[model samples]
Target: MSAQTIKGLTYPYPEPPGKGEWIEMARGVYWLQMALPMALDHINLYAIEDDDGWWVVDTGMKWGDTQERWKLLIEGPMAGKPLKGVVCTHMHPDHIGQAGWLCREYNAALYMSFGEYFTARALTQEDHAGADWRVIEHFTSAGVPFEQVQQMGRKFRGFGAIVEPMPGSYTRLTDGDSLAIGGRQWRVITGSGHSPEHVCLYSDEDKLILSGDQIIPRITSNVSVMPQEPEGNPLKRWLESLAYFIEQTHPDTLVMPAHNTPFYGIHTRLKALIDHHRGHLAAIEDACREPKSAVELFPVLFAREIGKDQLAIALGESIAHLHYLYAEGRLERQRDEQGVLRYRSVDPDHCPYAPADLTDEDVPMEV
Candidate 1:
């Protein structure tokens, strides 16, 4: 890709809220503010004027405070026009929490990739709120102490607050599908690991991409292996997804992410993220020269001052890295009778392991 492709793409602070004031990115694209209680702080929800009406991308959390904010924006700025539909980039609570309310209130259709929809339903379905006891058993069998497993069970119930119920029906989008919004054709580019079948929209006409959490300008999106997918090596899939995205999208595309500022250099950012994970993998491999439990490796992967919520994300991320390393033969995994997975490094020369060599061609261009 030529460097010129990324030129003229500028990052501007989103327009300030003035009752119903809206900032235009393209001719009809606008961003609405949403509240988040985290160091990351806020999520930017985009609205695109469609032939039918308005289409919204990503909803904020389902808290009453955020719902009230949406009510104000809808009643004021978008009061007259019909909201045609809602499209979620992924299944995270910050991205899909308000979906049910919007669909019910406006009678709008909801769209999401099939995988994400299934995963979202599985997660938010009542009676499925808590952690899987089998997952704790797996960890304990692998050698984690029973006390730590009990602590994890106690903390797992909190996830319910973030993930609200999803709408029963949704329009499924696949790779290569094109949707028109604001008179522009936005092509769906599917990615994985962060969330199953996460779709990032790209418009070649203006070189603009609604990157979702796929390609954030500031921090790398979290790639984790949770209890539900214990054998998953999400780090490997996430890195491959980044590389695939850079190769397919124009280098100069203006990336409007779900969070953080819009910026240039999508390829450069992808490179940085890949390097970041490689470094993390290497660090963990070195640490594993001596046997270490997931808890012991936690501080090495994240800073000590992390908040409880962040620590939870960090824990999953660390486990993902370990899983990837173990899969590649750089680390060895063992399970004790109690069922916890333990890890230690293996000599490269003696170990029967090979990393999967993935190239741009290996990545699917569409869902």
Candidate 2:
């Protein structure tokens, strides 16, 4: 990928790390890139040097090549010293997929937020029978065709396929916790919406932030309401989390994110993400001038085509926008005779709940 330059942010690395090579990002911090077979083809992992060993963050999915790459890393640049610990940013497979394997291999402690850890455990438990109707039911309720629901159900991806069996328990990394690594203290900053209690590490001494998926330079992290929490307002939580970051961090902090090249201008990026979602919420409200199902708002909410692979996530995000508007009183939701959920604009002239005049610092707390 080409180098990314924003207002005050600069991506020093023009290209990402190759198959078995790692890039030295700073004095003691190393960057590793792992392959993923998806629209987003890669994830960035970090290694912070410590007195005993290196502190690793964000393992890639449980793919065979990824395992091979890990082995190579162990014998190559990371020789002699062992892993001090493994810190996962969230419950997503690409972030914690190989946590079990890495921790077991290096005898390192797995550190993550409780919400992410428990949620991952719940999803990885495949003992339950039958197809998981959580997603199917969610789509069905959104006015999706019955045949489409069945098709999606048959191809529905689960946690086990991507994430390995998690360890029985993990060392919890709470918000405001300080982790001492390589003679520097990295404070844990937790955020919600992308995933519950996602951990982002910040070091004032180093002038850097390890932003997992909470802040990505290229794409906005998916902030959709999942079936697990049907009424969950993830968009609101996401906006609040962004507000927190903008309030707490500076504009020049170098961000080492999970997906794109590490860059500066964190406040700028955070505002962009917040603005992007607010724009979506506005589009959804306008599209709901007439009663419309979540699926019907896709064209207005998303710029590209919603293919089979992207349908589930796209629908969830669309529903999240609708739910946020409904909660904000900008839209009214009702169940049609067909049992499909429909949303209509509550008031065109007066939208008391609409998040207007949404300056980065002035975002409503209710958002």
Candidate 3:
């Protein structure tokens, strides 16, 4: 496939590897692809051949066919490489779903951040026969009809359904932790907003990074406020994470993302992600001219029609943007008579996404 360039970023690999196939990114690093049932149809997995064995990064969901595929992969593309360990970027089911089965199959240890491991472990044990009241209340407060909310509560599912049982112990990976694998030294860098302590592996010598969901080339990772933490400002932390990447990463460094094709121009991609969210925040703030429920502003923030399947996430992202503007003092929130929470612009003249201070050159003229 011929690579295409857009927006100052270069996609060196124009097309992703086909199912059950692998692409060698470097001498000992390989990219693997798997199918997903979600709106995003595929995920990219990475494998690094090390001295002892091969370490797999981010296992796909625990589908019924996954085990057979892994078996075939071991004998074929993996070259019968003995498994080293599984490195999970976060607690998300799509990333860590097969970690346990893979580790047990290879008798390898599990590597994850403490927060991710513990949080995932707890989720695996939850029995949500009915949805948690907090979750129902959180959605209701955003103007979701009681009937729809009740229906959600009835068919609630927990993480355990998709995830295999976790191993009893794990090796914790924190920010700045250096790991030796496949002759490359990978430094673990942790970021938040998508999930707690999302891990991104960086090889400074090779000028490459396994960016996980933190720096995907196309879609911006979802930064949400969970039902448990409704008042949190995850967008603030998300923006800061992007700023850090833009400042710290070199423009030429290659980015291997979890869901998109590998590419270069890390600086440009990171800034573009920031600008995308900035646009969302500004539009949402302006839409709050009159008091509006989070559900009501969905039209301003999202382009597609949201159905029942998308309700939870739709509400989450809406509240995430709303919370950011509210915390910035550009929007004020209150509860209506129906107990639905609504937000309105606090200062009509204020720009929610503007820089904190304006220099003389930035002052507006009658252009």
Candidate 4:
């Protein structure tokens, strides 16, 4: 299979900003790229000019260098003005890692969706017995290899390490709520599956949106079945959110995504995301005709080699695809004697044959 592409998706800016520097995206909006120690190497954080100071959206990871970069920005381009507020798109560490520090530095308020704020707070607690146990059991049920599980435990960053000290309280940003920044109103649009209540900001005046991870151009957002909600059908919620965006947003609006360069053609990206998940679900359903564990379906769903460090996320995503089919009545999941869940297609006659071997070229790079 060929890699998926959204035809109209075009990158106007060919280059990204260097460390401690920013590029103007719109009249009052500037974009900054920060380094991350992961396969996904960088995150795009935005700053909008506020009447009092700059209004920042999405804080980068909590690292010493990231902190020093913020300091340099304050003394350089962001000099002489205080940050009006810090608006986080979601609870993910890369998005809200330095929120507390920024709020303290500028005496700015922290704004996030209620779901994201409390979720972050809950994950930060060291003694959350329920959360910790759920993660271990989740992997075991998915049939993750023993050594790979150990590697995952070591690689995954705990919430506290990634997210710095957070404020005791935060102001909530709800769907449809409007925030006045840079003399214009930006409305809040919330999405799920990638994270709980992910926020995307839209400005009617300029037809621009700070579409934080909701409509990325290069890669599909990771929509996994996390430990906190083992049986949750996030794929269903994700498709609904995409439908909402496709139906509501204008095609002319320029979207500034969290991961990739900003681009236009919101409808094109949204449709591609929906189709991608649907294709994955169909593949999983076909592979389940003879009953298969989540681990067994990895090859059918993913073309890449899932390393030890990536096993946890890979398993979670595989389970997510299985859950979507099970939820839709296209497949049924049952536990075996060993207590591992296995799924089989509900209609074997119509089940598509699982491909024998998928080469690197056969799998979409985004998946």
Q: Which digits, one per residue and each the tens of the lDDT, describe model 1 over residues 41-152?
A: 7787788887668899998888647777777878876778899989999888788889988888889999999998888887665343345777665455444566765766
What are the models' TM-scores?
A: 0.85, 0.92, 0.92, 0.91
What ranges in model 3 sit over 4 Å off? 1-6, 352-367
Error of 3 at 354 (Å): 5.9
Give the alpha carbon lDDT tens digit for every residue of 1-367 in model 3: 0012236788888878766778889878889887776777777889899987889899988875666767778778677568888999988878888999999888988999998999899887776777777777788899999888888864356678878999999999998999999889998888888887888899889888998889876666777777767788888888888887766566789899898789988888777667667877777777788999989977776666667777777687889889988888888988989889999997766774742211221111110
Candidate 1 least-lDDT 10 residues: 358-367
Any idea what lDDT model 1 has? 0.73
Model 3 clashing-pair count = 0
Candidate 4 C-alpha lDDT tens digits along 180-298: 99898998889888888988999877889998888888777777888778878888888999998876678889899898688888888887677677767667777677889888988
Task: Give per-residue CA lDDT, model 2, range 1-367, as digits (tens).
Answer: 1013345566888699898988988778889989988867889999898988988999999975988988898888889999879999998888888999999888889999999999888877743333466656677789888787776544454568778789887999999999999988999999999888999988877778889989887677787877777788999899999999987777778889998788877888887677777766766777688999988977776656678777777777888888888888788888888778999997755643333322222211111
lDDT of each: 0.73, 0.80, 0.79, 0.79
Alpha-carbon shift of residue 294 in model 3 (angstroms): 0.8
Worst 10 residues of 2 by lDDT: 358-367
Who is ahead in TM-score, 1 or 2?
2
